[model samples]
Target: MSHPILTEKTVLLNANVKNKEEAVRLAGQLLVDQGCVEPSYIDRMLEREQSLSTYIGNSVAIPHGTEKGKKNILRSGISILQIPGGVDFGDGQMAKILIGIAGKGNEHMEILSKIALVCAEEENVSKMIHARSKGELFSLFDGVN
Candidate 1:
């Protein structure tokens, strides 16, 4: 199978998710819509979250993992989710946006580094949190190339 990058996947616009659970579900839905993953992928992702928190810091969380080469066989998904009340990130920080990425083998670190670079910029994070549509969010990565 051909493993593509995050840009090749479709994004979910106007994801009105309030918390981490809903955010993960929305991302999984996006993967499903893009024919990247199965419907059960969301449930598995949630289970992983329950096992351990994916939040890193600075209002960012990357809830990610790989399955038995089944549902989650995509590259990555940069889901710009808005946590209405914020979710505890285990470091006195509340996650405002989630960038859910799913890939294979050693490709995770590179994509994760890209995500980290994007999150390191406060301006970028702000723009993502306030993004009104998927088109706008996709535009954020325009210069990332």
Candidate 2:
């Protein structure tokens, strides 16, 4: 495979968000800042969160826009929000890593699958949760060039 959609610019360290909504917005904004999606994509991501929690396993949450959100994406990429303090993502899941994705096409499934592969191993997920820098976090990602 190739490098995951996540880039150094998109990874946030020690993000300060009080709740899941704020976390989603903060990370989604990174996608906007990268010109991957429009500002409204933030709200749409929140909507997706409300309908169904994106909290994957290992204290991580994958926040993304709804299907309608596709129209807002200009490019494909992911925004990583590392909240060491953790946030409750409903269902009693406290998410420490927020991987916000804005995939324009195949990038969505591709990135998601790669993330799944990484998270499948407990050690890998732990490494990501404790990663303090973008370089450290990027290293934990699997199947990436």
Candidate 3:
């Protein structure tokens, strides 16, 4: 019983978090709630962040588990959290969009590339940040590949 990579149920809109850690937790928790990964995966996500920032340019951050954490994944999935207010990712990086991913095997590379293509355009990132509803946010990733 594997879940879809991304689903409307996993898209959260208008989220408000005090910091990047909290934001990451919310994003990772969505994956957990959707049964994409085990509870331990969230800790690994934080560990990854500590080692290297996942904050890509254009006010977006993609957080995922470390290599060892992959074993905790139940299936491939993505969870999106839109924070209109934004959270600080340190070193002057503020991320309004948080994408948490859990990929089985090499699916993560595909997922990362797909997400990169969609997020390459600044306008798309802006639209995602200001999305009024979960459907709006979810639709932005539709047909992403």
- Which predicted model would earn the best TM-score? 3
RMSD of each: 3.4, 2.4, 1.1
1-145 per-residue lDDT for model 2 (tens digits): 2434678888998888888888999999999988889999998999998899899878988999999998998888888888988999987889988888888877788778877787778887778888878899987863642
Q: What is the Cα-based lDDT of residue 127 in candidate 2?
A: 81
Give the C-alpha miss distance for residue 72 in model 3, angstroms.
0.6
Q: Per-residue lDDT for 23-74 in model 1, tens only?
A: 7777666666766566776777787788878887767788765454334555
Q: What lDDT is reached at residue 59 by model 2?
A: 91
Better of 2 and 3 by TM-score: 3
Ranking by TM-score: 3, 2, 1
Which one is best on lDDT? 3
Model 3 lDDT, full chain set: 0.90
Clashing pairs in 3: none
lDDT value, residue 9 of candidate 3 = 83
Candidate 1: worst-modelled 10 consecutive residues by lDDT? 3-12
Candidate 2 Cα outliers beyond 4 Å, as residue runs? 1-4
lDDT per residue (tens digit) for residues 1-145 in model 3: 5456899888988898999999999999999998889999999999999999999989999999999999999989999989888899999899999999888898999999899888999989988988888878888788642
What's the distance in Å from true for residue 106, model 2? 2.8
